[model samples]
Target: MRLYKYYRPDFYFEKSLRYDEIFFASNEQLNDPHDLVIKPYFGNNKEAWKSILKSNAPFDTWCLSKIVDIDNDNLTRELNDEFEGVVVDDSSSISSVLDNQSASLAQIFEKYLTPQCNAMFKKPEAASAACVQFLKEKLARGWDKRYYSCSFSKNPLEPQMWAHYGGGFRGCVLIYRGLSDGSINLRNNIYISDSQNFKFADVNYQDKDKLVDILDLNSRVNIIEQNLLNKSSFWSHEKEMRLLLSESFGSIRVSIASGMPKSTKTQIFHHAPDAIEGVIFGSNCSESYKEKITSMLAEKYSFLLPAGVPAFLTFDSRLTSQGKVEINYGAKCIIREVRSSQVIKEILENERLNTMLKELGIPQFN
Candidate 1:
């Protein structure tokens, strides 16, 4: 259940030492190492960087893994001596390439966790659960909100692990409750794109407030992300979002939901088959949009969970040719949504640990 980890010695080494731990990466790489960084949104946004520093919202986190090879040294040497930079051409379908899901525990973590580490696990879910547990345990020991309250992807070192679909915040399921297994999806692959640099002005970050101030810079990034999404057309053909390790409706763990701007959500709701597949959080929330989300909340895409539970993004109409998935599951759904963001945020942003975890609806943090 353990994964080999890497860190940017420049940014995280010292902060992690405070907790004696490395946390999961959220949609934001500011927290921990991430894997699915599709687009590096925060790389150049300057104005948005300043706003996040002043705001107090909590951020998302992720952990990327590779199937560890027992004979890593030998295999690495072999690959180094013989590996080619190019992949052979083939007739593989994009869908097949995209559906490169691991079929078993062995296949999934084969190169991610060391052989000694992998030997202790029985299932892939267990390894995922252990990753979250490790983070939660650290929080149990207590983290400095001002410092450690920040939050990855495959390779755990791949460049994408630092990407965010062109927004500092990736619209991760945006918001959810009762269920943590479902992931967020956006159509059109649209997001706020910026080319401005927000780097510290030749100032060293060892300064007390520098690190927190730097991380705070991400606040306005989401708003900018939404604004950009608004200006672009929502492509119905886009359905690139999906969970990496999701097993079922109830595979709930350290889950995150991010709310998109109202105008952006409206376009997706009408243009895209589902605005957000399973659940969403509110931002610039409006009555009509609320109704749309509420209505979807009451319906079931298939029997995967229950009649009232919303469908996950994997079944988003944009992803399938049939327009919707009809798979039925007999299990009752425990994942649901929150109608009010203020109430949830008030609880989440507060420093009280027990109350925050309660509203999050997890026995522990994800």
Candidate 2:
């Protein structure tokens, strides 16, 4: 069986450069081209090289060093000539010397670069053609009917055999199996899993336009997921917290209160009927009290609410001897000392709050 190997660019370059540099340096001694070995660095090995390079040298420098052999006298002189030529060629233009250096480096790498150094490292022999072909045909049928067995045992097929049929089939099969067992969820519309990891969306059968659209959507989803994850590790912690909080609290109530005028609140509710089950315009509140309410609302809903939700503003009233103005939402009650016009606008327009209203199965609008 013929074995095929895949390496990430960094790994390929790292090994290729190390081998290429050693080969170039050796060639300087022996004046002959030595055949370099190409090996497939798979799984953990690929990641290991990245960790090494990240801690040692910056990745680009390490790869470039192998190609250029900057210390070599002949190569160095050639680079110098190229740099001087680029400088003179664009002397009248506004281009800086940095551009010349970049062009010179490109030329040097083109002439002297060798195949990857790690190409010498061999990947394991894959399954033969006969072994993987059946599996591939089976998986192409779609996930629901793909597998006959539910046992998590590995099929005796070899990797090379699967590769011969086509790449990614085996991985897809494993993924499908995972999805079936509830170990994984296949979110077809989004290329990323709920866990925020990427899946190689099917591209081979898609036409150019459809493929481009899918890729673009996937890229957007990835960016949004990454931003959410970075800003707050909230989603990751949410599941555990939900379980814990569920045990302690019989009900979770989300309160939407604003010091804004009743008209603005009515407008927001008209637009974002999904944000809250009910909106309450506090009759009277102080500036400090209103600020506190706005801050709390922003904290709870800022990450939870999707984009397009407007900001709430402070209302015109001030707190009297009553200390707090109270309004009752079906799920929770809110108290505040001041309300703003903008705050009412935001409360009425938020879709998430509207969705919360639906979830409660609340039939009447107060």
Candidate 3:
């Protein structure tokens, strides 16, 4: 597979070309406020409450106290009145009360009883409140684990992409060759045991909201997918993909460098050298910027390809009759006569290539 990352000719582009760095944005730093937001769903009934209680007992008691203002003193008395010889297991009655009494109870329930339940109570509403609070806290704990991602697109020729991500056709798009349909090779410098190194997911654009089943304690992977892989249909134009990296569990290191002060919010990683297939400059990309980039590839970053094989470079020129950007995929390099002095100097300095030039009747420089 191939992936495209759009970039403006800015400091970030310079850093990426110099360091071969791919930056992952933290979930909180994403542009969309609703991005990664998971709407947790826990059925307001006995089964959900039972699942909650099985997870944590103390949290259950705490939720009950906060939501209904009930204490240990009145806990048993309230339980007897509400449950009425029932096993205190049938929580459906309590949920029904929460549903009718407060339409906002569902939201409150998620806030309080997010992950688990433990305490028993007299009033069904109070017990329901406690269950809600218990689960809420548990879910919050799980959600606190930090996540970061770098986005990519399947298409590079789209004009809208050029406008939005490519700085209004003045930037460029990086191309990467992947191992499979949606996978890319990304390795970090610092190792964090038990943490995910990297994973690629093709973005799924849908109109429906991502609802996480908070009652299922074993659904960690599902939660991550729902939050990261899914996007609104409005973003479907991008044909997006993502590379995700998770922070090491229980570790405080935010950047891949570890212990070093982070100068930016981005988490950097070095990609496999050969993964970089080529670069396509936008229609309005400056000639000087193109020269700088091609020079870097010709000199320091030549290791990206096999010897004698130049990395592909092309200019996305003026719009075609179809109103689509024109790109000559046959173009092998971005060399321009405007910068011919430096390029020719470097070519002539190479003994192997200079000999070839002489054989072709090219004038020899002293």
Q: Tens digit of lDDT per residue, candidate 1, span 253-302?
A: 21211111111111110012222223321222244543443333334232
Model 3, 164-184: lDDT tens digits are 888888888887767764566
Query: What's the C-alpha lDDT at position 343 in model 2?
Result: 31
Model 2 worst lDDT window (10 residues): 241-250
Candidate 1: worst-modelled 10 consecutive residues by lDDT = 141-150
| Candidate number of the best TM-score | 3
Q: How does each model score on lDDT? A: 0.25, 0.23, 0.54
TM-score for candidate 1, residues paired by index: 0.18
lDDT (10s digit) by residue, model 2, range 1-366: 011111122343233222211111111122112101011111212222222212222233233333323344555455334433221111111122323344444444445433442242232111111112211121111111100001111221222222322132211111011222223222212233343122211101111111111112225334322221121222221111000000011000100110111121110001111122122223322345434444544443344344423333222211233442212221222322232222333332245445543443321222
Instruction: Report residue 228 deviation for candidate 1 (angstroms).
Output: 27
Model 1: lDDT of residue 44 = 29
C-alpha TM-score for every candidate: 0.18, 0.16, 0.62
Top lDDT hit: 3
Clashes (candidate 3): 19
Error of 2 at 144 (Å): 36
The TM-score measured for candidate 2 stands at: 0.16
Cα deviation in Å at residue 255, candidate 2?
Answer: 47
lDDT of 1: 0.25
* Candidate scoring better on TM-score of 2 and 3: 3
